[model samples]
Target: MAVQGTPEPFVEILMSTVVALVRRDGPDLSARQFGVFLTVYLGEGPHTVRGLAKELNVSKPAITRALDRLGVHDFTHRQVDPKDRRSILVQRTVKGAALLREIRAIMGEAAAASDEAAPGGATELRRQHA
Candidate 1:
């Protein structure tokens, strides 16, 4: 069953789980950090700090701070853009991908538990996203 114009059922749960994991495994990353991460992940091409800052409606310094924090967790890597030596690009590392996978697993477990406790749990999650 598909709900048109709605995000998938697990997305919100996965987001919640990932937030919890980030809180536990790394320095505190605000919802802004999560937003930046998700945007970069979904982007078709590489992401630059300035671009992300613009996308997230934050200052370059603020995005840099977030990137610095994420750096401590190996969640992102800063590299000089070859085309534009003055600019830096942030790329997600393998560790970051693995961590995201673990968080997704946690979310799946939570969704299952919620479903067990109350039916249509996944649908409820979708509604929350909506």
Candidate 2:
């Protein structure tokens, strides 16, 4: 066992590093925006607005507002599902995929940096190292 005087690992360090990295990268979308983008892209469409809201654990208006932001960038488009005309589906545009690729690259960098900075954090990866 390690000495108790050693500084306990904290997730805040990783979060701060990620936030700084994001700022340095000048992201097209904020963290929340990226979350919305990923939720849709990863979901692969034909999902109702309500379903997405539920999946994201956010409110309907929150999803709608996020969609509105995405529309402004032409990152996504909304369409009424044929089977359920009243329900809308969020589809990612080419631009959205390109943006997502950039985000993923940045995230990968952050992950690597975090691992390097915290060789043995409290997280599972650190446990493996231990």
Cα lDDT of model 1 by residue, 1-130, tens digit:
5487664446556656766676675556667776776676667558999899888889999999888878887888999999999999999888778766766688777677656666785867667868
Highest-TM-score candidate:
1
Q: List per-candidate RMSD values in Å.
A: 5.5, 5.1
Tens digit of lDDT per residue, candidate 2, span 1-130? 5456543443444465557556764435666666788788887666667988898898989888888888898888989888888789888799888876865776566666655777655454556556
Alpha carbon lDDT of each predicted model: 0.76, 0.72
Overlapping backbone residue pairs in candidate 1 total: 0
Q: Alpha-carbon error at 34 in model 2, in Å?
A: 3.0
Q: In model 1, what is the error at residue 73, expressed in angstroms?
A: 1.6
Candidate 1 deviant stretches above 4 angstroms? 1-28, 124-130
Task: In angstroms, give how far residue 95 of model 2 lies from its true place.
Answer: 1.2
What would the TM-score be for candidate 1 when compared with the true structure? 0.73
